[model samples]
Target: MDILMGEPEQSLEKEIEADLTIGDLTVHEDRNEVMHFLHPVVYMTNIKGLYKKDDVLETKWTSYITIFRSNVYLSIFGVSVLVSILFVVIARSANRLHRGLDESALVVWLDASWFTLAALAKQGVDYHSQGLSGRFIVVSWWIFAIIMSTAYGANLISQLSVHKEQKPFHNLAELIRSEDYSFGLIEPSITSMIFQNTKSGSVKQAWSVLRERAKTNPEVLDANPANHFKMVDSGKYCYLGSNYYLEAYQGKDCTLKMMDSPVSWQHLAFGMPKGSPLIDEFERTLFILNQIGFVADRRKKWFKTRDPEECRSSASVKPVNFADIQIAFYLLATGTLFSIMSLLSEIVIASTKKR
Candidate 1:
């Protein structure tokens, strides 16, 4: 058997049709009409998006608060304020009935607010409610605090333990919708052909976008797959291609990632002349190899990394660094600075009164 390097212009299907060479090509309905394909060598393989890892946004300092929805934060805030107001009303009424409590209304309000906040933080306050109504409200607030704090703690730990990275686009539709990314696949390839021929959907829309872009920038529909990969490495482009090819490229460049969602699924098989007699024989051989685990071994050897643990160490959980929770320290610093300013202001006011 002679091996020949296929070209974009002279595709493997054309060569096989001319009885020159049998080549492995993605089995498509159009190609199936002209060439005979052996039983699919690769099944359910898909086209995935490839992009640079640097393009993904890293976990921000505000991730602790941002992980919860806006509604959740609003609900917590609303409940805390409501509880503080209730506590203040009940405590003031009790103090009025029994003149032993000398705290002013403003002091009571501040203490109530602080108590509610401290309970939410799972901390204790020195002040306690004297009346039964006030004590009942305190117990209810404690229960609410326990539930909210437990949920917050669980969610925060789960989110922070895994370093969150947000990709620019999750799937092809998002990639198409995004104005920031320019995506292209190799021209004359099965994936590009599918995108071009599809009737209506994101695939067709993507093709239209590429076609329009190609009118000005010819690289948008280039025949060379290397150009697409190079564009992807620059962090401004996305490349849509076969999963197998993308995975092979990813193995070489750790910075490159294949999106989990696939764009399309296609069967991969060897192409032969329309009336090829070896299809049956090849199918039998493939079946036998599959049963003997030969095919599985070869696939693992080529497509998978030798040491997956080493390749994925960057994604694994490690001890939390200062950078992960620096927002808390920032809040503390801001509070201390405000307290110093308040003290200075009070000192100035007292000296002015004495003068």
Candidate 2:
């Protein structure tokens, strides 16, 4: 837009002022198309330097939480199944020890999970369990339980310890809340922090403001097909989205335009609990990401059009269960060998019985 408009990127003062100077921008006809979802993900680029840094920081925090919940290990159903199995094993083991243990001691053997393991061990039978098939099974079961428990415990620790994920925040309101800023954002320019933001350039706060709106509206996501350059200049809602839009829809009628000067110099980082212990390491990773130009690399990927082939072949692609795929593949590969082994075993047993 700056090139077409034949002007370099303007300062915040110039950007806002230009809104009043420029003639009314035509709202692209397609801006009204309703979306099924609010823009869950926002790519920040293209639009002039209207984005606020506070808003970006705030949105990154919000997106971080949403991504955390989607991990398979964090699911309640997955965790609950492991817990239920643990309790069932403990109950069974207690019943096995009931025979050798005294009546009083047996009562204490109830609920022998990690908490009661020590107490149950101390209450062990004074007499050795002899010819105790049930006791043998219980001990073996506990051993197996220990092994499985150790493996899952390792997984849980890994899930928490090394955070490799870094996601973009889509809502800036969350950032304003985190930074404890004086801005309260609502539609059509409702903000209590107006005075404070005006005094100090709260570009972060401004961008976060758009993020909150994006979180609520699908129109912000793919819905912004309009020529929104003038709208942004007017500051109804400051949008900080990716420049991908320019490449995807570069034509005479498209709405996106880039700003010359940075609206605000922002330190974009993955958001988490404030003052987190992982801050240093995470910050280092962020630096590495910047050094390697990871964000720019992602920008390239984000700008690429969604593969039309995938969308076209959607119906043809069977929704195969990952577990079923493995099981079926293995079963087919070993089915003949297993059948031969079973037949041979049955023949040998029959011959032994006849002899």
Candidate 3:
């Protein structure tokens, strides 16, 4: 059997119906009326969104802070303040009970706050609380500090070590909601037919949007996969297609990424005339190939270059560059400048007092 170059599905179907060639197409319920499909050789992930990686990379200075949720930060602050207040109250009471005199309220509060902050930062503090109650609170604070510090340290290391690229939209719903991306799929394909024929849901909604867009811009219904991928690489468009086809393009262009949201699954099989005698033979051959892992081996051989493990090893971890932590340097420099100003002010005040 000679391998022929693929034509448009309509022409390909006609050729198969006329008994000219045996073609491969996704086996769908609608297509079954016109063609006999052999046992599926490839079960493909269908209708996933593809977009540019550069378009979604986290660029904000605040991205580092996203390691901890807002609630976690708030809870930590609240707990630290509560612990400081408890320490101050216990120390003040112990001082009054034992010596009949206590330190100034402001001084005790400052010392307690400093001690609490030191523990949180995993630093040593000179101050030690007196009495059993005060000691118990200190021990409890230490335990809390240990748990929080451990969690924060682990999360921070993971965030810093793994370069996580963000996604602008995770699903068709989000893609529709986002105005930044214009999405389209290869027209005259089963995936496109599924979108156009769906009666409801995000798929239907997305098709409606694309239809309207296509009226103004015919490129929205492009027949060529290359055009869809080109539009995606421009950073303003998203392409939706089968994972098998998209994965090939993604391997060629590392800048492209397929969204985690898969709209459906499609089975790819060889198509022939409705009463073709070769169907049984083809089915049996495919069954043997599937059982012996030949099909899986071919898929791995084709897609191995873009395997997640290899991709992660090649690109995910890099030495943290100065630009990555530029905000930290900015904060350090700002603090140093403020400290110098405060020192100058103190020196001026001392000179004025001498005068």
Candidate 4:
């Protein structure tokens, strides 16, 4: 038989032991440990930044403008602009040799910009340069455009192929090692005691950190499993508790997940006062129950069937939203403003020279 109970705690195990010592009730020595349960496991959930939605786990979508934010992309863009400006300067200095054209500085810059853009697009310009230096610059820029275009194409293809899912922590050891996550046990519980007395180096370290957390923030020792579930959903928290309870609570919620690796194991037993006369009778009944397969049936009924809705819903791809592209819009606005200002400055200089 299985039952779940909760109460104001002073360590339930110690309370049971104290009752046995003081003769409040008697317990069976041979049948004391009723069953074995794997140690409490950790469950973590997050709604933002690396989470599952409608069953499928995925990374946040990349914004289109984000490509321009890359240092490499910006560097290439700056080089293209510089190369265009260099062409304009060369075109002016060598204008006498190709004397048929008469154009303003702004017109020269505009033409150079168009030529540079077309070259980057792998398009040929109709205009031909008379000077050897002009021809050399054009050839060099064409080679640069070829290499950059190839590199960018390869990088963009690689980015599109990969998924960016991020997990909060893979296991208990990882949870303990990370400073980003705050972890704690259901206080005054078997799992808490196990952590406090654990011989395992990783678990022991985790316990020490948890102890410090409790001292620093007394509320870190959460008494309620329900609160633990809430904390996990709220993000950046790892709740350690019995697998039985965790499975029961998270079985319905799609977002919550238990770590595959268990942190420890425990011997779960029913307790009574020492030297109780009914111990043999209880043991006999339990033996009969096990023999008839009642225990296994009960476990299969409650624990075996996990919710499949999460799995079923995970197939659909989530739609991309404005938050993903907000930064890109900001970058575009900044670039547009800067361009308008530059054009205005060029107009002012031209007008002053005419005056």
Candidate 5:
């Protein structure tokens, strides 16, 4: 029996095969570089992404932030519906008071509104004739903008002037512009900022810190902060998280909360290893989260149980002013406009391509 291995007396290190090594990196004999997944999941998340046992694949990084643009506008949609009805009533009353409505006029007005929204949204336009749905789209969009401008102006005045039990939103700008406490956040990077006076730690900042620290303290980046919240518990680290709401300080389990309204907003989503067959699984996770009303229900539960210390600290706050709802409305409108414009641009491109 001839048994052969390393030459007799060869060091154990000689028997080890390294995947990759940089000075002291000393990667294991049979593994690729590993990254710590900092958010909760049913399984391990790989930066290289989960690939076949033998095949290595390059993957695109996708966001795990849930998109809330639709929901914010949905709130406005309900309000818009109500306002539309009120406007219809006001127009009817004005016609009755100023010039009697023949009931026939009311019918024409209703049809016009239909054409208007479709046109404003850049969908085919009101006048289908001359293929001028294109021109009608532009015209309708301007009209809608004028209408929204008027509505926003009027609301601004009311929100500023009317001090009811509901509290006038008169102090938002100052609040957002005011200095407040800062804390850790989870994300590839935080995307929004309230003007400039606040400092909520973001993934970008965290990543920068992580990168700096990695050179001297490499163990942390490999430590999974997602599955375990201890790093942040140590109060020195931030969790690059998938769910922004989890960082809320007002919740029952809100280990952290915004010192002020979020300096930025991020969409919660499961980042996939771009082009992974797990796209279906990722979508399922989003669906399940929404079905669970994870954010909404959590907000309700957290809002009511805010810490007294936090409330007191933030108590001198002027009111739930511009920084909160107003900015939300702005974002909501901006997002809608952006989506509409993108759709229109696509149509124009398609039309041009066809030509």
Candidate 6:
């Protein structure tokens, strides 16, 4: 089979009867449709995404400090404080019912705080409520503790275990909206023409930006076929082109990845003349080629080797390193030092008073 490359519209201009063609032929508004399927318009970005072979979808790793700042912990703290204050107030008001429990106001407050802390930690405390109001508060606190603990546990497990993919852009829509990477298509290309004349709002928006960039920096809008892949490799630009070309360009570079979704869908099929007798035979052969792994073999030959081990599942439980909690330990040390100094000062003052 002889392979010829020409624009789909050119098929109408040139009256050569052919059996098949290879390219994504777009259907114009006049109901003219291209009859073969090959590849789609895939967006490219230099942003790397992390993924595990076991995971169906990729996710991003979040910092522990970020997890601590979540709404769940904030709600737990707020509710615990309110409940603690109520317990203290009720304990003092019904003081006669509880005999020889606590002597000072500070002791009562300390007990109240400790009670909430123990409940929040899901640990059982030795102390029990003496009065009816105190018992009701205790029961309510336990219920709150149970719900909050379960939720926090589930959230924490998901946060720490799930593998996250870190990519610059997730979809075509995001690529257009993002300011991090500059993107465009080659001039006089079919892709550029599609965006230039599209009625879709997003396409128009992207085209406007490209047009502006072209006015200032024409290099950004250059249509050189080779420059698209080169710019992507340099990590400064995002190139919009056929996934077929992109796949070839990727070769052995693991650093490059196509966007998960594409901006548009294109059909690739063998070009044939109108009412060609071999159209049915060619279509069947195409399907057979795909089923027999011919397409897979070709792809493997051109692209990088797909290795499961490269992005395999990792340990869910990460050991807490010193850097993870250094801030917390520093604060604790500061507090302990201040308390020791305060105790020493109090002892010295008492000695002076006695003298």
- The 0-to-1 C-alpha lDDT of every candidate, in the order given, reads 0.69, 0.34, 0.70, 0.56, 0.36, 0.58
Best by lDDT: 3
Question: How many clashes does each candidate structure show, in the order listed?
Answer: 0, 23, 0, 4, 15, 9
Cα RMSD, each candidate: 12.1, 20.2, 12.3, 15.0, 23.3, 13.3
Model 5 lDDT per residue over 65-155, tens place: 1112345445546645543343344344444433544445467457546654554344563432112232333343445545444544555
Error of 2 at 168 (Å): 9.2
lDDT of 4 by residue, 1-355 (tens): 3222432132244443222221111122222353221111112221111112222334335633343346556655776787677667667655643464556778778888898788777788865554655665666666666655554455455445544445666777787777777877777656666667668898889878888888887655787767777777776777787666666666666666666577875434344333655556666665676668775565467444465665343223232334433443344335434544544454466568669
Which whole-number lDDT from 0 to 100 does residue 275 have in model 3? 82
Off by over 4 Å in 3: 1-23, 55-114, 117-164, 302-305, 313-355
Candidate 4 lands at a TM-score of 0.45
Q: Find the 10 residues in a row with the least total lDDT in model 1.
A: 15-24
lDDT of 3 at 322: 38
- Per-residue error for 85 in candidate 5, Å, reads 0.7
Tens digits of per-residue lDDT, candidate 6, 49-116, equal 12111213444455444444454456556656766766666666556333534456677789989988
lDDT of 1 by residue, 1-355 (tens): 4434452226543643343233436777777676676664744478888888763445777767665566656756776776676667667766654444656778888999998898889998876766555656666666666666766786677667765566777888888888888888888788888887777588888898999999999997888989888898888788888887877777756677777778888776655557766667777887888889887787677566434554563453333433444453344335434534544454466468669
Best by TM-score: 3
Winner by lDDT between candidate 3 and candidate 1: 3
Ranking, lDDT, top scorer first: 3, 1, 6, 4, 5, 2
Candidates 2 and 4 compared by lDDT, better number: 4
> Which is better, 4 or 6, measured by TM-score?
6
lDDT score for residue 289 of model 4: 69
Candidate 1 lDDT (Cα, 0 to 1): 0.69
What TM-score against the true fold does each predicted structure earn? 0.64, 0.27, 0.67, 0.45, 0.22, 0.53
lDDT of 4: 0.56
Q: Give candidate 2 regions above 4 Å deviation.
A: 1-128, 164-169, 175-242, 245-355
